[model samples]
Target chain A: MSEPNIYQPFLMRIDKITEEAPLVKTFKLVFVNDEEGKKFQFKAGQFGEYSVFGEGECTLCIASPPTRPGYIECTFRQAGRVTGALAGKEEGEIIGFRGPYGNTFPLEQWQGKNLLFIAGGIALPPLRCVIWNALDLRDRFKEITVIYGARSVADLVYKQELEEWAKRGDLKILTTVDPGGETPDWKGEIGFVPAVLEKADPICENTVALVCGPPIMIKLTLPVLAKLGFSPENTFTTLENRMKCGIGKCGHCMVGKYFVCKDGPVFTLAQLNQLPPEY
Target chain B: MIIEKKLLKQDSVEKLFAKLKADGRRILAPKAQGDEIFFEQVASASEMAKDYIQTTLSPKGAVFPRVEALFRYQMEGKDVKIENNSEPQPTVIFGLRPCDAASFAILNSVFSWDYQDSQFKSRLAQTAAITVSCSRADEYCFCTSVGGSPGDTKGSDILLTRIGSGDYLAEILTEKGKAMVTLAPELFAEAPSEDKEKYLAKVPVKFDLKKLTEKLPEAFNNNELWMEQSLRCLGCGACAFVCPACVCFDIQDESKRESGVRLRCWDSCGFSLFTAHTSGHNPRPVQSQRWRQRVMHKFSYFNDRQKYLGCVGCGRCSRKCPADMNLLEHLKAIAEAR
Candidate 1:
């Protein structure tokens, strides 16, 4: 690891922009360096600080699979100054990017074990990086299951990826949408992620569950996993809060004693349980 | 080790000021700007405010500026060109209080510990601190409670205390301070018989430093005390910003079009965004939890990691605090708690 202060940030030209939902969009960026195509790397679940010049900076998780190098993709929602400006950007536009900051999920530790991936709403983007990495290297794991949800059918992201993964036939992909909405014309379940997890009755033995999404979804889903006999240690999740620097130095992104950017972007539920009940 | 004396009449002091300015060294002293005290570069010793409390911003800014360019860069066809930004000018900070002097010592740990930050280190190497003892303390001052005192002179090269009319007793504690005295030893006058009495009476011993340090570890596990103590704190982090010992910062890259520069800026933990994640989950969402983090990080975590207390007991946070959260009261509560 090189010294953190030696981190050099440069403008990455936006090669393409894909609208994932009404609010979420993915920006594919190629670094200013020609050699960037070969060396740009990030682990699954790690994030970066993206800047829109005069708009300031915001933390955005690298959503594209790490194995798929060259272009780094960040999926963002138009919530604040930088993200709103980033959402308004078009193809070939320039955006500032730094990092691959923070710790990533321990994928190597999960090899040969059954994996359960749970995500909700826009949270799917960061988890998708891991999901795709797992699928690409399918033989390394025993079984792969993805449980995902959104507010409505329209709120769901990566519809095309869902179709492709469903066709894979080697893994299980479960999806749900919140109540009080027009149901999609599909052959899948519809309910909150926690309720779906209880109904799906995922096997807890020899398995690890990776959960991500809104706080409400996680708050409700954790107990359901526990009820299904998954210990806190066997569960993992990625949490987000508003951030300026994606490094531990910035005072804001703390979860008790932990610096979310440094100590975790990924944490076991056992570790999460130790935190003050604020998250 | 204490140098006790009275100021010489006009000629000796004038020679001291002459040597300081003749060398092109920037000497920053405190000045009364309306209701606030601020450190400004002085051309002569006459410009220094003899009586002033802590400044609105600490002398930390003189070393680590609010905004500084790490490097300049330009974008070419496929590669970015970069240039190293050189060090700033050498400076001597005059008239720092003990709390302020001690904060620099705390800052030294953070910048030099894990990875050497040359940007801050270069400034520390070039800058020297001249501390002045406080004759009277305000409600916002608790330096003695946090391993410091009104007369604690560990961080300063040259420590001064007022003894008589138009006179100062200077203690040359370090080689850097000895160099200054060597340059102008003619400024020194013979000590008066009553100099020791004036030194003790003028600079009052305020708090028991040893008792406070002993009580800190016992206070660490008192969660109820911390919870109630931090109850009113809005968790805005204004306290940390105003504190002399709070050295946390955030590094950000600001770029325009094709190129940009990475900047380091002051940051605090009270803000919700400070710990927020991109995944729309925050571990410290409420005021209680955030407040706990502030106290625990300073008192427990930093001590565990660096073997030093994170605070210097400066009540500047309590003085400038918007919410009126008094750290002195909290410390006392922790000290007395079961």
Candidate 2:
């Protein structure tokens, strides 16, 4: 009875909120307890269970980079009941958070390799953590290229960050929208994510690829990456199964023998190949 | 832990029950409701159900409630406050079968796997299991095939088996059991001369559990096998509800504007929505896949990860199944398959 609760969450204050897209918004959260804030740590691929008091908890990746400490950010669309509850809140309001769960992306192993980030729609938040981390430590890696796409120009999240990355001389950014999903003045390429990735074919040797997107985007992009000589081991992605506890218990998320909350939210394509297609 | 064997007179059971009740411990024993039996709190041993192989539902609700409050949350102006669930009362589950008793360990393995769950831990820690050995088993019983027997004292505080003289052959198996003796030591007599096995039920090993576990991973993609086995499956979730070793759950928030409690409720893999995402994507969409998950998770996944099998061979699912889906027959078929 004296043990600390695994279900109880830390009180987090919403310090800042950004309206990223039409329905997508990001909240920058800071721990209300100063001691708890100082002790909190998470890696790139890890996620958390964010609660909205009246509504239930939602499993969301810590969208902000671990390299930039002191605050954590989460971007979500007004999709479901929990997410709708989350989106209703404004800056300075409080929410409940408990996490930093799951395995981290092996950033130390990919230190000297070129980083290729391919993301689609809302899935970009999960990959953006590692993308920003790799960019912040730009001197440690080679050429970094990002190919991001959405259903339409209005659907693309992190617009400001995409603009900032495009202006950065060190990085290569390619933005795309689906066929016929472009606005009249849309400057980005008009195509699906896989086509944009195939068009902007970067060399695959000594490169590490991180892909996160809808199921269809992943299904189509994997062959494209494989054709470009990126082996299964060099390709990585984070998986999201419907989870409740966001821990090993509750038993909502599993991809074969592995507990996605414990064994991974992040897995190499080779590792995923070893598992059954349960997620 | 070493177990000390002793004899408990049939009349002494009532005395022990009284002593436990007087000691401020809540005693939950099987009570017959119409034809079905359930675990409920009783003041006297006479209220205990007679001649029941297993309860309609496993005594799992004793250690893990059907619905439990994980935490309480309150909205205070712009801030939200969190409250940890309070500790449970000291509880003793009496007259559970050995199969039901053994399931507590499987539940323990899951709750304490990597991140220890305090709510489950506290509930389990405060609860002690006292099991009665089964002297009679129906066709549904298969505990022997799953590495357990009617007289198995694996997960019991005290294990009691009725001998030739109708007296209980008591195995004081744990400190918790000894504590009950400490409350009233005079009630326990000298050890009985009768063999405890003579009084227990004979449950045959219908299938090879080791072979079944080994065959599960190989049978993962055997769509024909799963589809055939699950053709009659209603996806009713009755199997999980009656299962002692099934620990899957769902977390939800129940609120009335300002104050709310986060509840952990029972869930089953067989339910389609159990693995369905909000984006209209379902990984295990079909009943056959869900059936395969139930089989694979219990036999293959739990053994590989937790070092404990997720089924105790209680066969409550088969007994209570509206579809008359015999799990023993299915398991035997899977094990004997080429």
Candidate 3:
């Protein structure tokens, strides 16, 4: 064959396994081959097709930031066949990953602007890549703020990382839980993501907001952002569509004329408005 | 692309088949299977179906199989051993329609558009098409409406049109066809004064393709129209299964504890599971939306992205649809929709 197989994945060994939540785990995977590891590169917000050799592949974001190299991390909730198999894997186990697919967040455009990140529940992983990216290059941006919420305090992923971000002086992090989901010793806000975002009321001028969450959270949060004077172009989000070949060939990820794998997983609110609600 | 046409005596077809076999190529041709015709391996030209207007399934499987093993794997002590699927056997599609022949490029545009699927590429490289022009067409045939005709040669390495006097007018289209001619130099003769079109089937245009493509984007919001059109749809996927240009597939692995093979099998957009997320939230939840997607992808989305229409106007889909969901009628409805 003149060309190599596109579906063939790079073999990665699970370096570390962190139990982020009840059934969610973050796997820090390193390339099995040192040469492959040094050559590998990916940006924040791009996703991969994680494979459990016996099971099929699942589309998940590179939850880890690009600032750190040598390995990539993926945070997934044990929801499906592939994820269940992935969660069952122990550290040092081998897995397959065909990756860095789809588009990335244009962080260069957000430089010198306030970066506001709003995330809900399991959707936090995609945004966490950008949140850390912005934090790593803190001097490039003006103010960095994170308002992350979930169904409950127990359900929030990256618990240790959240505490670390909260301790950092360069950024402000506000964690929240749904009204009835808070514990007696809970220290964060008690409300849904939209309500919590509205209560904070951050300034919208020269600011770019990245929001990723459940459909309802997104639907409710968009209007709140608009109310706070955030324009459609200033707000960015990523879309996750069912994919087989994550490289635009498989017709599953098409949203109208655009392939979510090609045109974007990242799009402005204005771009989303032009597309049909297929995703 | 330049075309070199020649006339072959009626007796020369069987001789050419012998030559192809001698060239170490497996010939795939349409054969009768009960009532339906499907592409099957044949030893000689005489075994090929003579009266079929079109096969029940496309000859696309010659290049892209229904289920192809992408890789074979075995677990070692702590490492995994991977092996790419071996090269596909050289194949020659003996007698496919021009419409089905045209589907190869559309499929090629997809598999090679971004990341080259070498599995598909290798198969295509090893395959050559010898298309037989239609002498008769049925109600479902719409080759002309989609910029094709019974005599149109798009994807064939060699196009054979039956002229008067029971002879064949062969158009050597590619290097593969030239190579075949070299194998049996005596069979191909000087072109006869026979126009291939005179003997070809006349499939009148049913709907204006340009109008249909333009109207489809605007009509995408009309879910009620899709519902009405696809009311009888069972989502059986026979249409997509038989379609020449439907390239959607699902990757799966079947293992026997120690070893396994990863296969990419044919999948359809009409299936509910095609776009269902693991979270149980499906993007295309209803049948109407799926039907709409099938139409829109072929008419609008594919045209915009791939620079090629996804439908080949082969009519296998309309003929194989168990629901009797006539694609032509629906397309006409979409074209005429306000």
Candidate 4:
């Protein structure tokens, strides 16, 4: 292969776009070159720098699971300049993507153990990758519990996937909306994810908890997990930082000594405790 | 291995410039401009500033420019065309101080860490550095504290030390230096064995690097100290802009209706926007936190990750800081903290 140009992005066409929630959309991207698609490989919890041609790039996790190949999916809210441009784009439009960067969740280590997924609001996308990855390899895991929450009933992403997961008899899935967020007809739980998790009271033994959410949610839930007898070593969460150049060189995504884009985006609670809380 | 040494008459320095220019190499030399010295393209030796402690900016711009276009793209109907900028031309930077020269190596660790920055790589490959040893020291100079010296030859292709009023001892350290020598062989003569240190500057070590390294990590949570120290900081980013080792950058796209170019510009950790997330959350939310990041990144974090000190003890940041925030003073305070 020729020398790799670090900043040059691979062209990916948006095959489909889903309005997962208000202001949040999921883009199903396929590589413009079929050969590139075949070679592209990413594990759960890894992120990529996605760009609009005339706009800039932003870091987002590969929302789609690796078990399903041929295309990658990313869910982003219309927050900033790049995401606004990304939100404005239609299907069949070409955008730039570079990555499969950072370390992945140690899924093999969780084999034969129960898996608990805790996420909030737009943060579901990062955990969704790991959730589907474990579900696809169903035999390797025992009981799977998913606790997801959003600001309101309308704010939850992947509604179809939530319904499908709830219907599965093998897994226990609980969805929640914050207090005062539920509609009169809303049937799911009403409260925060951490509070709802405490009520569910899943067995902490032989289980790994994967949590992703807003920083506030993560800060609150981590303590609850400790109270519920989940070891810090077995609890993992991915960090989000403002980044340019998904590789390590750019230097903006650093949290303490660690480059969030390289050393992590994924870190266990045990690992996080050792690091400075700058993130 | 024995290194070759030669002498060049100070007056004949112009002849060396003539030869370098004739060979089609762009010569970047420190020149006196208004109140400060700046590294600018020079046509002749007389244009160079003869007396200056240090330039306003580091010579990093020669390799990693302030603004660089990665590629230009144009939309041709539904298809897009990309044209990468050409590689840099062979260039020579003359009169760079030893500390600034050493910074190139420190910066190399970051640029080539995981993703190779080809633009920076090509510029570094094509450029040759000629470092002049400091003959006088300033209060802000502390090269010795950070594993460097006034006459350190860590990153220079050629090391030049003034031996007398009109004579310089030239030690060619790299093949590029030897090639420059070959360009004008007659200008160089055999140097008599003499002590060159007599003419060099003496810079005192201000702080204990070993002690500071051990204490800096513990200082991360000392928010009150950081807040007190950074109270006067305006967050103008002057220190980072003038620093030789500060390598943070921002990438942007400039476009018209159908065409645009992706440009990378120098960024600073001192800026509040540096770590601001799109969701209106900032990891380093306060000036004190940002200040802590600068100190921790340089003295602790960078060493842990890159196996080298991010700072070269050039003291340019201290000199350029408008808030009078001195790195040496801060480091001393950090060392003295319980």
Candidate 5:
């Protein structure tokens, strides 16, 4: 085998940063070397480690679906050191990034089946990648229902993108918040993600439910999906954990014997059930 | 032939060390400092800690470094430039014990199994281990219970036993070890026929390896007992860190502006985030559940998947554990329980 040192490192420059919400923002990155940029590859559910040089490093899932190329997106909240440093970054700034690592969402398995997307708060970013990937390949699936909500109207992310998907002729989109407020324009459901999912009454047969959000929302949604006749095999979800390394070697992101970066950032309910009940 | 205690002079050992250095091979041996011992790169035999017991840190740091570079990268206009990692140099680790050597075997199973970890594989290919047989066992050591003995050659290229004060008998177990000794044949005194019998007399534990291996299957799915056993662990990861067989790692990309390098570092299972999700869900939130996973992986799951035991029973965990949780006591409890 060739010496590992012979392989050059991967570099990416931050082109833009958009404030998705008060606590969340998305950074647009492009490779420094044009040839290396073309060689850059990643799957939908894969993530990358972004670094703030002297401060430290943090892991973020690739927020953009594989359907889109050239530019990559990483959405993160203002937490911890590196993330806080990243939050301080402005447009056209330079940062370090490597990967398109981890297993992507199982798009092949969901092809020709109905896709039910359930998301909560800012957790919608990673799921958004799948939503766009499915929509781009709309002919392959039966139906798409997106149920998303957060603390309030201001807390909802990708409102413009959601508006675009809602405008499409063949999609059902429902919006909600935990507590309704004085905002007179609010018209969607006002409850938790699980409650909203039940009210939507998605068909479980020949369908796969893709869920993401806070831990409490996920805990509440699993039973609801089972109640709606979705087998453990038919339900899927993405995972986020405090990760120091985006690879399996760093012991931070493991669930039983499975490493989230390698075995999955995306998993079916059946696989999740088999894992140790830590996350 | 066994040399009398008086005949084993320090000068003869120095000549062997000088010969190895002249051949451009690095020889590492244990060094004694008061009550603590450590493996240091050696210049001569005088630097070796032949009389010392266990070191504070396992010699694993020599093979799989505590910190290693994976790759380097730089950024330009929404693009990334990545450079691959560099390979390490070749070296032999001398005087490793059976427990430490067996840890390499356990590590090999994980690094080489599913997706071959090139970083680990490359270093392993160029390395050799020379293990010394235990003349006196420690209070914490229980290698006999975990498919290893003080004289097992599972991960050793050469097995050495002291026949007399300074005269050692070496059984060349691998081609690499044969090469190691062939480089300086004048240093090794030819072994006498009775050397094997003298070594076996030092066995400390009457372990039923077959019984322990058989009882492992019955312990699977018994979470309640595991929970009770692991209740006191503070989840500090000290046990995993000190263990010779644990091989979990974390990879990170450390960057400065336009340049960044990927790094692979050691990790432990005792942390809460070992199995946490970014979406705020944690599967092994409780200490009991995490501890169950540790035992299950070592004894049951690894065996079921890889057909290999995940522990070498170096007893470093038992020796270093502040909570005093020992794998041998726990396994014995599980095996003897009704």
Candidate 6:
């Protein structure tokens, strides 16, 4: 058969749904066609356009790692029309998915080096795939540190995964909430992520830092990472822009000459420094 | 490769149009619509505008319409069934100027870039463009500045240059043009071997493209210049709608209960809502920033990707702009920026 049209989406059924946080849900989707499911492969940091049949499509990074096959997972918060419709969907419901688009994180370059993942709020989904991928291939890397923060303790996603990482003897996981966001029984750090990151002080020597968050969080976190002696070339982040066509035909998600949908959703800080700050 | 040249009498041009229509080809040509000339469906050659300098809108809509249904979908229990739209029919676009023809080549680069849009590709494959060499130009005409001319046949299937009062010099460019000739071989004759450049319009170079390319990146951080220049701009998006090379689009679904159709509609970066995120954060929060994006996308970003300027110097944006936000003036300002 001829190649399917670029716009036509593959039917995917939601096998499982987990309430990651307030207004946020993680969906485990399996391709309805077994042939398509066997043929699909994507690395960490690549995204897909998920559609809610009658609503519209939204771009989201595949939250599940490639090591786990048969199904792909995505985490999304109730934000707009499409996400709202997706929030209303139940298990066994089918949605449209098109992708595995854009560039992947350069994990091979960070082999044998310490890996530090820093994410804020709902932005953790983009980094979760990489975190698990590195953990799955544990012997290849030196040390793993995850510093994730959210607006409040209730807003933190992947709670079960966070507990599992915290219990692991080989990795260091630091979770935090914003100032005044902690309850009376809170055990994690209580401060802004950038400030807590400075206090945690993961050694910058031969370490790769992956950071993803809101624009303001990213803007403030980069300077702190620079101050902590993290090389801009080794520091990476993924940008989220409003997109229509995830394959770069639509011109909404451009940062300078780069299309976020094609050239990158993942970029090194050194590369981001060269681009215009429009994203 | 040597290009074959032929001649067609003005009276016999109507016969070629009749023959094309008889073959069930849709003829899209520049026709008068109230006060403005637009590229609309024409039945005969006489219905086409005879004295228009340029069409108000470019012929880009022939392949990429303003709004088109991508696919229709209906819910079947828990499953959704999608039906693709029918492929476009063969078409012939007559009376397009050389600048407008060149714009098609620029649009092709974006549409065929990472993801091949089947709707646009199918329509473009079946469409034949017949460009007419310009005999007159206005102050807004600056095709010569951007590596195009009044007689350029870069994206045309057939180029017609008026050689005399009742005759035209035809240069068949592609296989489609050759096929059109086979339809009415009796009307086309051997060219007379004369200078056709004398009859073409005179469009002067307004700015240095090399200098503009170099200075545009530096001007990206100069908010004062962009803000001052775009202070009078009203964000109506008319410029983007009229521009042939502006290919930004939005995908939306219109559903009624159990069934719906997804549509791809024309969108513009000049508008404030083009890049606004769902979380109430807008990257381009002001009109100046949006205007800067439009200028930089055409002058800088496109050159980086395709090694060609997105603007074909067609001047449709300037002509259709509600406010006097002239593209040539901004480009010249960028070229002359320190």
Give the runs in model 6 whose Cα sits over 4 Å from its true position.
A1-3
Weakest 10 consecutive residues, lDDT, candidate 3 chain A?
A1-10
lDDT of 6 at A8: 81
For model 5 chain B, give the 10-residue run with minimal summed lDDT.
Answer: B1-10
Candidate 5 global TM-score? 0.88
* lDDT of candidate 1 over A1-279, digit per residue (tens): 123344446568899888888888888888867775567677888998887654567887888888888788888788866788888888876767878888898998889999998999888988899998888889999889999988887788898888788888999988778775436575667788999999989899989999998878888999899999999999999876555556554446655556677778888999988875545
Superposed Cα deviation of residue B13, candidate 6 (Å): 2.0
Q: DockQ numbers for every candidate?
A: 0.24, 0.84, 0.78, 0.61, 0.28, 0.65
Query: How many clashes in candidate 4?
Result: 0
Q: For model 6, how big is the iRMS in angstroms?
A: 1.9
Per-residue lDDT of model 1, residues B178-223, tens digit only: 7777677777666555442345323333445445456665554566
lDDT over C-alpha atoms for residue B219 of model 1? 58
Instruction: Write down the TM-score for model 3.
Output: 0.98
lDDT of 6 by residue, A1-279 (tens): 133478888899999999998999999999999999999999999999999987989999999999898899999999899999999999999999998999999888888999999999999999999999999999999999999999999999999999999999888999999998888988999998899899999899999999999877888898999999999998999988899999988899987778899989999999998987788
Indicate the docking level reached by candidate 4: medium
DockQ of 6: 0.65
DockQ (0 to 1) for model 3: 0.78
User: DockQ for the candidate 2 complex?
Assistant: 0.84
Give the distance in Å from residue A38's predicted Cα in candidate 6 to where it truly belongs.
Answer: 0.7
Candidate 6 chain B: minimum summed lDDT over ten consecutive residues — where? B1-10
* Model 6 Cα shift for residue B238 (angstroms): 0.8
Report the poorest 10 consecutive residues by lDDT, candidate 1 chain A.
A1-10
Instruction: Report how far off residue A14 is in candidate 2 (Å).
Output: 1.3
Estimate every model's Cα lDDT from 0 to 1. 0.74, 0.92, 0.90, 0.90, 0.74, 0.90
| Best DockQ among the predictions, by candidate number | 2
Give the alpha carbon lDDT tens digit for every residue of B43-149 in model 3: 87888787888888898888889998889888886688889878888988988999998999999999988788888888999999988999999999999999899
Candidate 2 per-residue lDDT, tens place, B63-138, comes to 8899988888888898777788778988999999999999999999999978898878888988888899999999
